[model samples]
Target chain A: MATITRVGDPADPRVDDYRDLTTADRRPDRPGGRGLVIAEGVVVVRRLIESPYPVRSLLGVPRRLDELTDDLAALPVPAFSTSAETMAEVVGFHLNRGVLAVADRAAPPDVTALLRDARLVAVLEGVGDHENLGALFRNAAALGVDAVLLGPRCSDPLYRRSVRVSMGHVLRVPFAELPGPWPASMALLRAAGLRVAALTPAAGALPLASAGLAGERVALLLGAEGPGLTDEALDAADVRVRIPMAAGVDSLNVATAAAVAFYGLGCA
Target chain B: MATITRVGDPADPRVDDYRDLTTADRRPDRPGGRGLVIAEGVVVVRRLIESPYPVRSLLGVPRRLDELTDDLAALPVPAFSTSAETMAEVVGFHLNRGVLAVADRAAPPDVTALLRDARLVAVLEGVGDHENLGALFRNAAALGVDAVLLGPRCSDPLYRRSVRVSMGHVLRVPFAELPGPWPASMALLRAAGLRVAALTPAAGALPLASAGLAGERVALLLGAEGPGLTDEALDAADVRVRIPMAAGVDSLNVATAAAVAFYGLGCA
Candidate 1:
């Protein structure tokens, strides 16, 4: 069972981890940053409780804390209960979802360990946008992709926006930064017996479904939506697959396209 | 050719349509509404120029206006050039992409016309979120989806946020409200000889790929992420298809699911 404590003062030290949240948890790369993982709302908080990260504490309204009773019973942690007004004051904004959980970041897994048991994985290059990274993890989790390997120019998945946008799937999906060098590092997947397939909107690329990828151990490479796969990244793939889009239409959002490709490759 | 006009002051009467854009345009459906269709950024502005909606005028920085010179050449409307700072004052927000266009909405095409030409159409129920609706249109356009048919609890696609999020694809995608009673209104598509298939995650629903949807004319029925399609709507469909998601996960975003289904049914 977890300890439940009532906190009324907005400046209470017990809830220091939850204070002025907006400025306090700015990305570690930003100034005045602590980079703690903040999960909002009941669903994401539940996920945070279940995630591998060590829980520091929780702050929420009584009603939301009441809703997490079953989850709280399974974990040993301190949960601070307060009114919505105090939570808004301390968090520096009105969090409509009513509850929040903050956890320390865990060291990311190694690329080799991440791909060890994975049959399908996503290889991302230049996916620097936070929401796109979060959405990609959400898609990867839902579509049966076993792991995610981050390439150069990708944003930190633990960024608050990415964590929230991913619905905490970033906490569930194992991800690792590729170690060696750009494009060359991708050869590691090939050596592990996974075929490297790059997704591009290039006209000559074979249609995704017709690329002979169904049920194959595959790593699907994707670039950010606008400036697609860097030339070197495209050259590294064993095969290039296209989604066969309409003329004059721009490419689909990076995460949305990744979902389609993930579904096609995983279901195959 | 468009009449070139130089506007030196933010308070100029000619730019009234673009004034207080953030506040005035947001509640266009409320009591003091001006139901104007506004398009922002270069890409969307270009789409607005080509859409059936009548372009009233243009407000842009000289650089943005100059980039649209060819597009302006074919239009007889006023093209007002001003500094970014002046444009910001009128809009009450920093205008990135630096251009804005206002168009008057035209009567949507008849539903029968949509059904006659469309091989695949999307019918949305309770997709009240504008960004989801807009992103759906972008995907629909890319996947060669014919038209979008709105059912109920939807948002106005002409909203500024929707326009920007859809990358102006809303201007290109043809959508109209389905007439008659709620779910029963769907019968109109069947009456037009299109198969109405609902996408859901419930057991007993055929897996999308194996549902034998390819080469068949399909009108995909989608609902909001949480409530999804109502029992009435599900029962009305000729068949229910599921995307075969991993267990314990929520459904895919309605638009993303629609794209995968659209692709499965063969966009061409």
Candidate 2:
């Protein structure tokens, strides 16, 4: 069972990991950044407990902490109970969700290992927005996409904002950076028997519905919202598919477009 | 042609429509609310100019206004060019997109007229989040969803934030409130020769892939993210279709779910 501790002081050293959270270097690549995985709210905190990340501790209001009693009993970690006000002071913001969990980042799964037996996967290029990257992971998880392979210019999926936006699915969905040069690294997916299908809005590309990729192993390559896929990435794909959009309408948000692709391709 | 006016005063009464924008009564329904539609940034401002809504005027930095010169040249409205600092003073915030446009709301399209040739439509219930609603309209426009019918508990899509988030597509898509009672209001869709398909994540719901809704005239019923459709709303549907999500995962964002359904059934 987890130990329950009352932390009345906002400056308590026990809760130092939770200090100045809004300004902390949550970025994965910054110098001196610890890349601590922070999960906010009861839902995401519960997911953190179930995730492979090593749970550092949890700080939450009494009500929220009580709600997670069953899950807390199974884990051996300290649970800090505090008032909503002190919790706000410690976290540097008023988190309406009332519960938070912090964890250490875990090593990503090997690309080869993640690809073994994987059928539907997402290959992201230039998905730099944290929320978009996070929402894509949530979509990937729900739609049965086996894993996510981050290409160049993708944001860290474990960014605090991303973790919150994804509802902690970033913790559930295994993601690893695609190593080596940009488009060249995508060849590894082909070697693993997954067809590289790039998603573009270009009129010349085949419509997603008629791409004939259903029931076949596909790595749906997605780009950022405005600029879309880089030319090299589009050229690298074995097949280029478009979503068949209306004329004069701009492209869909990167994450929303990814969801549509994930569903159409995964169902096939 | 729009008359260009250089506004040197931050407190100019002529720009009252753009004053204290961050806290203004942008809500259309509230008393004392002018229900003025606000479009921010160069892109959305341009869209506002082209929309059915009557363009009131334009307030922008010289550069953003210069980009819209061609569009503005045909409009008979005042264009106020001001310094960025003065614009910030009037708007109560630093306007990053550097342009703002205000318009008077136009009458909604007649429901029966809108459904005449709309092969794919969205029927929303309780989609109170402005961003989700806006993103849904953006997706609807992109995926060729012909129209949207709002049911009970829906927010006003013409709200300023929705206009911006929709990438001004809300200005393009035709949406009107579904008249009559709550679930019973949905009957109007069937009478118009459209199938009422409610999207739920329940176990017994038919998987979207196998529901055979493609290419059929479908009015996809969507509820908000958390509670989803009410019992009456679900029963009122001609069919209950699910997006085939992985177990243990929560539902997709209502807008994203609607996009997947739109693509699946719209292309059918």
Candidate 3:
């Protein structure tokens, strides 16, 4: 069972992991910075406790902590109970969610093992916006995509804003950075018998429905909203497909487009 | 041609339409509120210029205005040029997009006329969040949804945030309130030779792909993310369809789900 500790002083060093969280979670590569995974709100905290990440501790008001009593019962970490005002002082902002949990990122799953029996996967390139990245994870999870592979220039899916925007699905979905150089690294997917299909709005690409990806092992390549997939990545894919779009309209948002393509791929 | 006038002071009354925009655009129903349609950034501003709404005027820095020279050449409204600092002072924020345009809300298209020749439409219920509403509009425009019918508890599509988030699609795609009482109003869509398909996450609903809606004229009924379509609305629909979702996951965001359904309807 977890231990509940009452915290009153905002300056107490015992709760340093929960202090100045805004800046503390910004750049994990910075000196004295640990890339800790943060989960806010009761629902997200429950997901964090259920995730593979190692739980450090939790900070929340009494009411929120009581709500998580079942989750905390199995958690071996300390749960800090504090007033909303003191909690806000430690976190550097007024958190409306009333509860927070921090965890250390676990080692990523082996790429070969993750792809062993996967049927549908998403390979993202240059999707740097945290919110978009997070939302993509949420869609992938709901749509039943097996895993996500982060290509070059993709933002950290574990970023705080991404975690929140993904509704904490970033914690649940399995993701890993694609190893080795650029497009060549994608060959690993082919070795595991998956066709790499790059999704683009280019005029010449095959339309999504007619691409015949349904029930096939596919790794859909997606890019950022504006620039889209690079020519190198496009050239590397086994096939290229596009969602038929209305004339004169800008392409759909990246995450939304991914959901459409994921559906067309028949992952669900 | 638009008349270019240089303004040095933030308090210039000529730009009153652009003053304290954050609060100014809040409630169109409030006293002294005009319910003006606002467009931000170069792309959205150009969309506003091309829309049916009557342009009041434009306020922008020289560089952003220069980019819109071709657009302004065809517009009759005055263009107010100001420094970035002055623009920020008037708008109550750092105007990073560098341009703003205000337009009066045009009368919504007649419901019968909007449904005429339309193959796909979205009917929204309780979608009060401006961003979700706006993103749905953008998705609707891209996925070739021809019109939107506002049912009830929906926010103003012309609200500034909705306009911005829709990428100005709200101005191009036709929409109107569904007339008559509650779910009974949906009879209009059936009268127009369209199927009323309610989108739900209920397990009993037919899965989207197997629903056989492709190439069919469909009026997809959507609702807010959390409390989805009311039972009354669901009971009234001719058929109920759902995007297949993974077990133990919440439903997709309303707009994303709409996009997937719109794609399934074969509108694009």
Per-residue lDDT tens digits of candidate 3, residues B136-215?
99999999999999999999888899999999999988999999998999999999999999999999999887787777
Q: Output the number of the DockQ-best candidate.
A: 2
Q: State the weakest 10-residue window (summed lDDT) of model 3 chain A.
A: A25-34
Candidate 2: the clashing residue pairs are: A214-A268, A215-A268, B214-B268, B215-B268
TM-scores, each model vs. reference: 0.97, 0.97, 0.98
Sliding window of 10 residues with minimal summed lDDT for model 2 chain B: B23-32
Task: Evaluate model 2: give its lDDT.
Answer: 0.90
10 residues in a row with least lDDT, candidate 1 chain B:
B24-33
Candidate 1 lDDT tens digits, A1-268: 8799999999999998887787677777788678899999998888888899888888999999999999999778899999999999998999999999999988888788788778999999999999999998888888888889999999989888898898999989888898888989988998888999999999989999889987789999999989999999999899999998888899999999999898888766
In Å, candidate 1's interface RMSD is 1.4
lDDT of 2 by residue, A152-266 (tens): 9998899899998898999999999998898999978988999899999999899887888877899889999999999999999999999989998999999999999988887
Model 1 lDDT at residue A11: 92
Instruction: Report the lDDT tens digits of candidate 2 across residue range B1-268.
Output: 9998999999999999998886563674565466788999988888888899999999999999999999998999999999999999998889789999999889899999998888888999999999999999999999998899999999889888898889999999999999899898887898989989899999999988788776678889999999999999999999999989998899999999988888888665
User: What alpha-carbon RMSD in Å does predicted model 3 have with respect to the real structure?
Assistant: 1.4
The DockQ score of candidate 2 comes to 0.90
- Chain B global fold similarity (TM-score) for predicted model 1 against the true chain B: 0.96
